[model samples]
Target: MLVSFSPSLLFTRYNSNYSTMESNFQGIVPASDAPTKRKRPTEAEHIPTAPKEPPAPEFLCQDCVKLDLSKAFSVEDTSNETTKMAFAPGRWGYFNAWAVDVGHRYRGTIITNCNLCQMLFNSRVDEGDTKLDGDGDWLRAVSFLEICGLVAYKPHRWISKDIPFLMLFSNKNYDLYENRKKVRHLIQQSGYAALQQLNQQQAIPFSPKVLSPVFDLGTFQNWFDYCNGNHKLLCRSSKSDLYGTHVIDCQDQSITQHEPGMPYVALSYVWGQPQAQKAVNDGKRLPAQLSLLIRDAIAVTQAMGFRYLWVDRYCIDQDTPTAKHEQIRQMDAIYSNAELTIIAAAGQDENYGLPGVGKNRPKTRMEAHIGDVAVVWAPKDPQAAIKSSKWSTRGWTFQEALLSRRRLVFTEQQAYFECNAMNVYESFDIPLDSLHIKDRSKSYEYLRRGVFGGNREAEFGRLNLEKQGPTEVFNRYLSNVEEYSARKLSFAEDSLNAFRGIAQQFWYGKHAIHNIWGMGYQTPPEERTSSFVHSLSWRHTSNCWDLSQSPQRRPQFPSWSWAGWEGEVQYEIIDSKQKSWFDNLIRAVSVENQIDSPTALEMIAPNPDATCIFPVVIFTAAVVPSKLISFNPNAASNKRWQIGKYKANLALSSGSVSESQFAEDIHDSHVWQCVCIGAALKVSFVMILKVDDGSDLWERAGIFAIDCYSHSLEKMMETREYKSFRVR
Candidate 1:
């Protein structure tokens, strides 16, 4: 079972309403314990307004209010109680800090409202006084006071007297002042000692403590040296500067031509808008007029003991289209051969620069003192920041990040280090290693236990997919396609170019697969025909197509190929039981194209012009005229179609296909040709327009599927004779 992981899951928001108790509880205490008598203060006396801030000695207050509920409350009262508790003063500020601390300290420990009130009241009570019980009259009196608004209570629990856990908040809406103060305190106290202690117990190294605003050169140098010596892959690749036109020399800060075998750092950032060019002359020194991002990259490269740095704007001669195209072709090698890739993943554009690099760095750490010991809080994970950054969305940066052997990602919160082997965050003490574990739960447990006893060779062997079967290779390609489709491309034409490197990898590398027009590929020579047909079985996911946006068709690209679209795409899985039935239906497949003509299929590799064109293959499959019966009558407007007894869903193609024809075809069966396309989750078929064009080709209409267990359809499909047609 292959488990899919999303960045959203990694940075899931903390649920504050979660209960720590084994059993659910209603927040309300017994009515019998309610105070029967109360003394009212004189009207003339000034009632203190809700405290502007949480009570001083914040840690004490935060530590005192631990709640443990006894019974679950009715849904109606729970809602009412939650609203009433919102009246608590200063709950979102310092009061929140205490709740967060307690939650982190005792994760999954449930506390009831009665127990929580007793804890808070006890903290304020005299040193020798007994602690109030959950049902105590004193607790009820305090609750009454809180309910009456005479005293403010922090709203920490939901209807169930359970307290929800607090995950670190994004800096967007947090109080920076308090956060900064706490961060400063944490840094001052032995550089996140508490976090370090936790990490040590977990056997994960704590993030290196940075006492200064900027990165420490010495620390970076040590890390660089360590990686160079320990990581074989980092040291194995030969250095080359052929891709870039100019590289900044760290020694004299001069712009110079990239020298082969000289190590350099590549800068990956988003180019937000057209900026003034800082072009370099052959002999003249590099311009000092660099953007903040470029300057920071230079500083980082020099600090990391690298004498050269490659930045696209300065390195590639954008003035010459030929030169730019040539450099673009070497994009994969450029990043892969570099010492390290510096990712500016925090801001939207180049002007934002690298955080903590300049003097005006934003404060990201917070600290609070608990007796003699200090507690610190900072953004626990910088991965969220990196994943959500504008840079991650850009088409060019997608390949840059993936191709790079190692990446030092700078985010708004902190820097993170990633490589093929492991991922480390500046805020985390642990480094996560890559393991081919399909079970998500077990993978997490492995991380928690710091288990590094897995077979290294076996784990690393997974990358060499050539040794594996075609299924593994196909699955990897599909995964890449899934991720690539979700990314944005500035220019729609660059879609194929941006993803071409991955195609090249699958083609020339271990997979040894022949690249198709971003639809299918040729695997083993014997299975080439089947592979081509199977690749066409992709479908548009629910969020893939934006019907409002005008669809642009790339030249030489067929409507069947995903590369023809501008959004995400997913392949329909064929039914395992129906796999043989669908395969047997396809008699042959022959792909053909004009030998000298430029087609979309030719651009399926890293360098399109250099890649060989796949001969146009003629597919011979069982074709039958079938009418589509929509499961929902409103599907015409909704863009959904169903066929056969299984009511398998089908995605309609955009452009040139007539909706009127589809409506007419369902009423009169001869217009729809169900061309069998291999099976995965179900028997897959492509519905082609039956109209005769001057040429021998037929336009793709839509894709549909049928269940293996559909006896009537299977029998009907078996009766049809195999027919051959050319796919343009």
Candidate 2:
């Protein structure tokens, strides 16, 4: 049995009024147990009068009181009662450090007596480790903390016994200061008391300040109002036709048309693989048997004081291909024009309802406290919650999140409100005015400058030419493509469609180019030809190919674009120092679109039945002969190549060239023709090509770069044959 303490005996040292053994006890303990009060020895020193704290309550457990928090207790000190109480065998403790009998008693006392002790014990558990029990089963928890040498306690602010005692556990013998700061940064503070602490001490890291068991709708309303009233970038109305689309009347639970620019909430969630969708047949009432996600979203919309909600499954007419395609095309406007997009980033499928939304809101926040300090185990970083969720991995959800001006993201742990200006979470109780200054270096800021011309702040405008260059926009587009290309798509054909909204957003207005037309090119024909060819320098990630790989190629997309391949692709970032040597060898005279004078909107929203129009680049470039000298199956790009006396690097596009085919090319003495597209520094970027069955059309064999001096390249260019190659 565990050693027990009577409340009556514990209270004897304090005032009779303080009978409560719980955290809220607000009476002073006997002076012997009080923390050494700071002394003002000199009358000359300026003294600031502070509000007198209520009596510091006496702890029921004597073992907890005797702990000298300032000193590090070694594992050998496990024999002491205070040591046993402090380092109880729980989730994070090293079990081997304690004696078997002592650990059993420690566990018993922790589970039964103090909630703070119990919570701290169960705070952090490593993967593959089992829960330590009072019955003497330590499970598979190995002694990793043993290396830290000694555990010490650093006391935090404390007042009423109702407010549990807050103390940081660290190893004074090792890295105690750094560990304390790291732990403090991770813990989420709560209520006005914690906020007061934060206001007083800027050094105290109380990030992600608030987390409650139940989500407050009033808080969300405040955030919504703040974003609507203040965020200028987010407030600008979308250019797309918002009134043409349909939205569900959240109050009526029926699909209805709203007036122009009517505020509606858009739902972005994962449509689980092979799951049955409850679509609105006549664009009227919601289905009687609705998914949990849809039902919860409607409730959330109504609660947030929005009359309309737009969910693709119900809003878009899935049966009518024309209507569906039209809605798909206006995705940029649909999400951007909405008051805010509700991102259901929790759970695997639509069936998994939003946490803390409806009835049976599972309790996610865990609360505990010591004598006068409330305690909570720090939540995992908010970004990890979204990154690991099923919703983040989907292709369709990518554009839905990026295009939105404001996002109300709901994860399993907590809800977050992210706009172009700032991102705030329900876990933080920070004042709205102080949010921008709060250090979020550790937290994930979902706002992207690459999408929709970045943040609302005057200083960070992505389109500001004075602050940022034109190449920065194209570079940002490449970065977006790199991220979007890695995302999973249920249907291979929907790959381009999934990313079209972001493409459309990038192509809109003076922010990028207007004459991009159908090819999804970020630059217009008037821009430097080098900038246009730079978009085509994307190489597949090393993980894209394997020994038994038959890559699923999207034939609808042209070979020059990253969309033609299945896996992730990345662009080689150009250095500013190399601009002097940069040269455009090929001229993109014109992009021959299949349709005559198709607008950017028409190109962005293409017909699903027809193959996407490939923009055939009609250009003249010097074609030089190069041979593959060696190949490495492990290296994704930059395999050695022989170009006369000088060597070069070849990156065979995985969409068309396989390792076996590349090996065969090298063995068979195949002389690959390198079409010089552009030059950067010492190397000349080339498109390795092969004739299509002796036809006039030339398909992209691979992309190569010859490692030679600019003068040497110019020498080679004079002798090389310039051919007018029609590349698709």
Candidate 3:
């Protein structure tokens, strides 16, 4: 039995109510007028502008002639409840049809007046196929069978084999069956307003679903309830109090302390083109004129039955240095313990409201009908939408998402719920039992959950040592840093601050002694020497679009860390082939970092034995004296320098100071030193440094690799001088 829903109930303002399912079939293309059976074609011919009327026919194909389309088409009312109605669902058929590679003549006649066929043919013709004449005007009488499951016959075979035919199936069949070899139809906009209403009504009943007309508050509340009650991995313990110190009370329109065990929503958004933010007055009330993004966030928080919303701009006491530093230090905890983070990922900046909340989001899906069949044009990937948004490019938002246990993302297309355990979307239902988290290539949650195996503490414990050999755990950290470095940061100095949460999570989550300057080292005092050297061996990529953009030093940060640079760096983990070279190098004797305050470095350093007074790192290692033979600024990085007699290249880490200038400074002295860190494939990786200000301290000039096959390993080590170097 066909179930018919009242259009008024499905769409509140719809004027056209659905009549009882029409059983009678008349005036929907007479069976006798339908095309007769014919041999299938191998090559598509030019569709003439006007085909002459056919004479009395041969035998007919009953299946093709019996298609009744009037039973499938209907019009729906829009939000205004006017006399004009929008398009609605109609009858649709699904078949596992084999696409044929043939000409147009032998193709059998089927549904000769199909609007779908005409649209498809016309669209294909518009792609500059001059060899095919007749501007699709003749397609008004062409058979649907000619274009079924295929773009066109031979002469118009512009479609690639990998491109799937856009087949439209019945709503029920589309959800019930797996997409295999199916027939496709062209999806066109029959009516914009009508199609938008149709999408809401048609998509109302699926599980893990979102209601139509966007930002239906009740629907969003249900998603939170479901995830809260069902996803064990996303739940926070009652004892946890990592939420922000201050939160905005949505109902009171004021800021207040976040109570323990109370659920609060955090917000992640781009604060594009800075504007002055006034501090909350004595009353603790929110500012009257808030950005649309924050205003929408408050409404959503209230709609989800939560009173408190944590927005960084308002929650943190930005004017107070101590409070700001305290909040910044706890960034990891702030995001991790939130009930869920609301990510405003639709627009360029905070001024643009969240789509579907305060703003009326344009419909992303459109539907139209042909006879009894309905076709739709819908975008399926939510990840693509989020990735394209301006919010994804910001440096701070990276850590915000990475630390959050659950995130409710609002993109222009739709809203979606992402957690370590599952992903739910507003557009349609996805069966959770069949979903494998690792298979989501575009999802950040996939990377988040996979890195720590859904339990950060346990995963950290398991990877603290290289008992059986090196694990991918450390490599994952490097991969994340590489991505983070490429992202845009509003202030270059905030580079480390933005990535602090991720760094702290790894540094202090389990074995504290394993991390130094955001790089991973092995545990135990004996193993750290080699791990430390390996961590320092990262190199800037040579294939960058412009070398000037990267390899630029962040003067405030130490050169030993990737954080000291403005761009991406890559670390090739020590492999068995290069183990000999790594073992041959001089081991680090001791390392110490100077910081302003001990409490400032994530409150506590994981390594209690190491000093963390300031941002400078002092270390001692064997250094080799080498002459600066020549320097070529124009050459590619691999052949840019000549150190001693070996062919070498330098990865310059200074953008402000030119290599030519440095060469000029050392022209008469010609004194240079190479601190060999590791080697592989007869190549030695070394850090080049020079005496700083005629003092005992040495400043890193750049990193270089020398071809070492010409000299023996012992010969290379014999020329070294043991010395202590302090780099700031």
> Among these predicted structures, which one has the highest TM-score?
2
Residue-wise C-alpha lDDT for candidate 1, range 521-590, written one tens digit per residue: 6555665555656667666553214455434445455555667666556654322211222253466555
Please list the residue runs of candidate 2 whose C-alpha ends up more than 4 Å from where it truly belongs after superposition. Answer: 1-206, 273-283, 359-375, 437-468, 514-528, 547-551, 574-590, 593-614, 622-624, 632-651, 655-661, 666-672, 679-686, 690-694, 704-724
**How accurate locally is residue 442 in candidate 3, as Cα lDDT from 0 to 100?**
24
Tell me the TM-score of model 2.
0.65
10 residues in a row with least lDDT, candidate 1: 22-31
* Model 3 spans > 4 angstroms off: 1-213, 216-226, 234-239, 242-244, 273-283, 367-380, 436-470, 511-514, 541-548, 573-584, 593-611, 614-650, 655-672, 679-684, 705-724
Alpha-carbon error at 82 in model 3, in Å? 63
lDDT tens string, model 2, 213-261? Answer: 3345556766666666665453455656664578887656678875685
Instruction: Report, for all candidates in order, the number of backbone clashes.
Output: 43, 16, 20
lDDT of 3 by residue, 1-728 (tens): 01122222211121122111111111011112222332211222223442332211221233223333332222233334666444322211211121222234212333333323332322221222344432212111111222222111322212111111232221212221233122122221111111122223322211122223345443345555555555544344223455348888776778888777666789999985665666644348776666777767776665455667889998888888777877888888888888788998888999887776655566333333533333333333355567667888888998898788778898876777776555556654433332322343222221112222222222212222222123344544655676676677877788788888877666643344355556556555555665566667677764223445756667766677777777767655433311223443644434444434223223333552242234544555666554435677787856667766677765655522556665554443334456666664476667766656666656666666677742443374555676656665
Q: State candidate 1's TM-score.
A: 0.63
Q: Flag the better candidate by lDDT, 1 or 2.
A: 2
Model 1 misses residue 47 by how many Å? Answer: 26
